[model samples]
Target: MLILGIETSCDETAAAVVADGRTILSEVTLSQDLHNLYGGVVPELASREHTRTLVPVVREAISEAEISYDDLEGIAVTNGPGLVGALLVGLSFAKALSYSLNKPLVGINHLEAHIFSVLLERPELVPPFLCLIISGGHSNLYLVESLGRYRSIGSTRDDAAGEAFDKVAKLLGLGYPGGPAIDEVAKSGNRDFIKFPKARMKSGGYDFSFSGLKTAVAIYVSKLNEKELQKRRADIAASFQEAVVGALLDNTIAAAEEHRMARIAVCGGVASNSRLRERLKASSETQGLLVFYPSLELCTDNAAMVAAAGNFRLENFPPDDLELDAFPYLELGD
Candidate 1:
């Protein structure tokens, strides 16, 4: 099926065309640089930006695919777990488009879309595998048995892994989008510079907690003078990155082992972290497990992933009856 995907759950306004979930016909994403000035997203600005760019973005994707609206078999969109206004922009556009085009409408869960991001590249990836979804708004561990079937085995207790990265980056005076900033700065520094805490669940479960680790970073940076902070900035980035990566790798590896699964896929914005990609690859290799991650573009919010996920949903689940609405707090597999 040829699916037109729209994604505006966050600051980015994206649209794409995918064929049968595995083939990307065409895709376009316009990122809102406006958010950078505020060091975080402004929901109002995000929705306004989406409203403005939604038409052009989707038009460009269809034009790039060399297909008119008549060629599309279905329309897919992200409708949940994001700012209500931002999500509404895309959902409204998608629903209207679907109705006018007489195409099937599929509503996608944002987090579930992240998990399916890898499927676009690795079509062979199927059920009976573990997936670690680490992003700005989410840090979850799931046992993906099949399309639309998710068993959440582990998740965050407080701030997500990417959220901690952003918070720590702010503390270090790193600009917006902390994951990339920390990844770049930590390259030349020592990962063992500070023995930052990597919390392990006392119950021996897969659940995670980054609040303490974030507080520790805050307290450590607070003690440093201006000159000291400038001198150790790279070290701080490296050490903090190490702590976060450690917790992620340990939990994922443990989960894979406990589940007796040899294949794993890590997706979402945080999966783009150099440290995370490197460590997960290295650890998976050492433990004789296969790990998959989407490319940098797909790791961030994109309509391609949404379309890719929606293709599966369209095949498995029935299309919505137009009564569907944007759900700002939708859970995966809901």
Candidate 2:
């Protein structure tokens, strides 16, 4: 099936054409640089930008795919668990297209799309494994019993790992979109320079908490003089990144082991982090397991993953009505 996927879940306005869920014919994404000035995404601005760019992005995706709207068999869009206004722009456009073209329409869950992203590259990978979707807006661990079947094992109680990274980076005077910034600087610093606290849930499930660690970074930074902070910034970034990676890695491995699964997949924007990938790869070798990840470009939000997810849903589930609305707080298990 040829599907056109639209994604405007947050700051990015993207569209893509995917064939049979696995082959990406063409993909286009327009990231709003305006958010960098604010140090984070501004929802109203994001929605407005989506409205402006989505049409052109979609057009470009189709043109690049060497197809027309009439050739599309299905229309898929992300409908929930994101900024509602931003989501509406994509969902509404997709609805209109689906209606006009009389094509099948499916609304995809954002996190589920992230989980499915790996398959775009590694189509040979089967499920019955664990997937960690770590991003600025979410930190979740799930056992992929199969496609369209997931068991959420754990999630963040407070700030998402990427969110913590952003906040900590800002505190350290690093720019916005913190993950890459910290990842780069930390490369030259000592991961063990400081002993940052990694939160351990008292209940001891696979659950995670990063609020304490973020606060700890803030506190430590507050005590430093400007010169001292400048001197230790790299070390601080390295240490903080270590703590966050440790928390994510520990819970993910524990969940996979407990479930007796040997294959693991990591997705979402933060999965692009060098440290996380390095650690997961190292662990896979030592622990007698396997790990998979989307290419760096696919790790971030994009329409191709949404298209892949939509292909599966459209095949198994009924098409959604035009009455389908965007969901801002939709959860994976929901």
lDDT of 2 by residue, 30-142 (tens): 88989988888899999999998988999999999999889999999999999999999999999998998999999999999998799878977898888999999999999
lDDT of 1 by residue, 86-117 (tens): 99989988998899989999999998888878
Measured by TM-score, the strongest candidate is 2
Q: Can you list the residue pairs that collide in candidate 1? A: none
Cα displacement (angstroms), candidate 1, residue 158, comes to: 1.1
Best by lDDT: 2
Model 1 — which ten-residue stretch has the worst lDDT?
A: 325-334
User: Candidate 1, overall lDDT?
Assistant: 0.90
Model 2 TM-score? Answer: 0.98
